[model samples]
Target: LSLTLYALPYTLAERIAGPWSGALAGALGSGGAFFLFFANTTDYIPVLLFSFVGILLGFTLAWWRPVIFYPFIIIWNFLLFRLDERRAPAQTPHLLHRHSAFWDEFQRLPLVGLDTHLLLVMERNRQEAEAAMAYLNTTRQRWAARAAQIEQDARQLMACHSIAAIGEAYHRLSTSEATDSASALLRSFSRISQDVDAAMRQESAYNRRLALSAVEDRLDGLLRELTRSNDRYAARFRPIAAHWREVVADVVQQLAEEAEMRQEIDNPYIIGVPLTEKQEIFVGRSDISSHIEQLLLDRRRPPLLLYGQRRVGKTSLLNNLGRLLPSTIVPLFVDLQGPVSQARDHAGFWYNMARSMIRSAQRQRDLILPPLARDALAADPFTGFDEWLDQVETVLGEHLALLMLDEFEVLDMAFARGRLDADGVLGMLRHVIQHRPRWKVLLAGSHTLDEFQRWASYLINVQVVHISYLREEEARQLIECPVEGFALRYEPEATARVLALTRGHPFLVQLLCAEVVALKNEQPAEERRLARLVDVETAVPRALDHGSFFFADIAQNQVDLTEAEVLRLLARQGEETAVPRQVLVDYFPSLMALENALIRLQKRELIERIGDGYRFQVELIRRWFARQPA
Candidate 1:
């Protein structure tokens, strides 16, 4: 009976701690029981000896297999109770009552009750631990699946070769949900893919093949590293690595075959394409940039009109304004020729504008602007856009927002098509200029405000900044040193001849120089380094051939019959000679008609008046006209 009472503490310790702690606790409890109840008794020696041995055996069994510990302990205590009753039958009832009273008192004790509550809490904690582990495993599995999907998509993107496909892939990668490292790695590959495509377009086939081979080698190395990696993050790129390497190897072989068929090398000059902010080919435009800065400082914040003819580098200048302006001024450039003008309604227009503004702010200044969702603009587009701008202003703090709308004429065309309300758009611009102290509006187009009567009223006090052909020195810098490590050099006479032919027209100069480079490359290795007067003369026809689109636009789209006639007559007079107004008048049916044609031609920047006569603005253009059918 005494041993049965002592076993309770041993069982409790086992439940709370483990078998070793239970054994230690049982030994202490049994020693106390022996000393307190049967210290000098030898009559019940067998029962006492059996109780001690049973406790040892039970605890030893518990240590070996904890599953049976509680049952074994209960049985051992029951056997001891029977043994106590049999040995001392006369005191059985008294001993049982004492045992019952002691158990009731132990259960009532605060520490014992508290231990029971702790056991309950521990059981609850065990359940919670299992639940947490299950959740972690599920999360890891989900991430593994996501990584697999990203790998598959990346492999498909790697197989794409066309610029349009690569552009679509980039858009998909940029907008899709992805891990940061995965997104960054895919964007890097997208840029490399674009470089490969550019080499195919601009360099020789042999060079393109070399580029493709290099890409293959790079992919192969990445495959080896990814295959060996055991990290979870590396899993995102691992599945794509081997397949991408295979695709690149196939592309390299295809390119090598194409190179063997016919290898034609294109010159490095970038013709017709507007220089991006990343391109180092853009030369000096300090004057225009300085003028813009001064206008930005004006307190009234008048709307600016950047007027220039087509292909005069208006877009390029706008693209680069973020670099030229103060860091406090953020340039949000929007090409109205793109999706902004193609929108079907006001909601689409404002949404596209807001999207462009956000993108440009991030890209140019690394500043995050408040996002304007399309759905937010579905109710009231203008109001929603205005609210978004208010949030953007908060983010900008002390910065000024320069809103540059390039190819504003395209938006006007949209207005004419009734795709957007001209009044609402122009009124918004006027309101921004007048009401928003931190915002400035600049419109870039080929035509002046007077030509667009609808814009003239809304944009009051418009400050006109004319962008024309490069200044002579700027043009010379562009020709001689378009980029660092330029291999081609021009003799003094050859450089003068190029300037005479191009008249510092940016497009014409690039076109002519590209042709000159192509011509030089075809020469002997020794002759290829230096461009002579003969080389310049030789490149003129090729330049005219390649730039026919630019010249044709001027003849067919910009000028009417009367203006075309005037230009052809000027061309016939030669590059150095300026045909007088009287000479043009005799050719026309009436003087009024000739004067109007001349004014229009001058507005187009196709011809310039020198003292009472007009001549072609660019000699290369004159040469194009000289080759045309009379």
Candidate 2:
């Protein structure tokens, strides 16, 4: 009883203050228990020693592994209880009767202690769950912000008017890493934008309607996709989709109203700018193309000259030669009016040439040519260029290359300015013509070989192919049907009047017909479709005003003082009337100077000798000259 009372404080200290503090108190309790046991009897000395060893093992385990220590403590207590039951069976009943409540309270202590470990595990799980929820919330916020940015970019795409601006907005939207539905919808909008641009550029209302119908079809598919998708951002895009539909409908209605106002006032004719190969309005070059093809087949492969007056479709012919020639014959067109003539040195010139050749081959025939770096031509440029041509020839295989140099006069200007060496440049061309059997060269210019004496000396056996006004039938085709589903019709007399005024000149024909369409548009809708002779007459002054640049170039640049006087004299004589050479001689002091001016005027195709007299070649030009001050 004394030992039990002394051990009570030590057991309570072990549960409350941990093993080290409890050990100090336990030493005192153990000393008292030993003293009491020795005083009473020494029979339980082995059991006391065994109990001390078990307590030491439990402390050792608790210091190393707290998890194992709890189970060890439970097992050790059970073994001790069993041993005491066997050794003190007679005393157990008396002790149980006296201390039943105390033993029951002691058994409940382990259950209460086990709850601490479970509480620690529960706290760790709670912290992990909270961290996971925070990450998910942050991810959701980031996705929402990205989706909002994509929506803003899509709105900017819709507001774009030009192809360049639309493309830029689409680039931003695509790079935003939008959802699949958003990407698909952006692509649909891009297609619709392209279709609308094409429709606005179309000359015929019928063609415009076809393009707009394509836009409508694409929009319908997009609407169906939007309906099927359950994307979170779907609600955000619904209003934008509806607005796009309304915009397309408004475009359709506006085009319909415009169609009714004027059937052909969209002005299909291209003025000043050279016609592209794909343009349907480029008509009546078959004869010139055929002549060029025949010359190309010559055994000597002479350097051909496409000689014509200014604005006579020379560059246009060069641009379209790929379509005219056989597929085996590749046309590499270099426009000297651009960077080629502007190059400062031989290396720069050859580099630009190579670049143009490569681009032209790819664009025209889908043929990939070997690349040439500008550094490759830094030293010995001509030799470097020649070596590159060897690679080009290997790519050509059995095909022939037709190199067409347009506006050769511009390159000549470069030479005259001393920016280029005339001898070195012309000699290289001469060497190419003489040495390269698989290559043919064609130079298009306004001046004749005789005018450029240097070119006359270098390019021997040059065949001249003159490009003039269009044929009568070709002019008619251009007038009535420039493109498929042409909206305007021409009466026979009206057509004949156009032929008289333009003299079948390609530029003048388009100019006069465009003016006639403008005139008819001002009248009632009923009179817009068919052009009458009165419409042709009423459109003349407007045509002259609209084509003032074409007319003024002839007076200011193409002719000198003597040639201008000769033109004015011819203009004074009516449209059809011709002045005899004898009449022209009276206006000039020097006969030789008068004859020289007449020869130059005729060579320019501004005048023609008709029945021993010279008359204006185009009536429109004559009227333009008549309006000019003497």
Report the C-alpha lDDT of model 1 over 360-442, residue by residue, as the tens digit.
89768988787777888899988988888899999999999999998898998999999999999888888889999999999
lDDT of 1: 0.73
The most accurate candidate by TM-score is 1
Q: Write the per-residue lDDT of candidate 2 for residues 434-472, one digit (tens) a residue.
A: 999999999999998898999999999999999989998
Clash pairs of candidate 2? none
Off by over 4 Å in 1: 1-152, 158-168, 171-200, 203-266
TM-score of each: 0.67, 0.64
Worst 10 residues of 1 by lDDT: 105-114
TM-score of 2: 0.64
The C-alpha RMSD in Å for every predicted model, in order, reads 18.6, 22.5
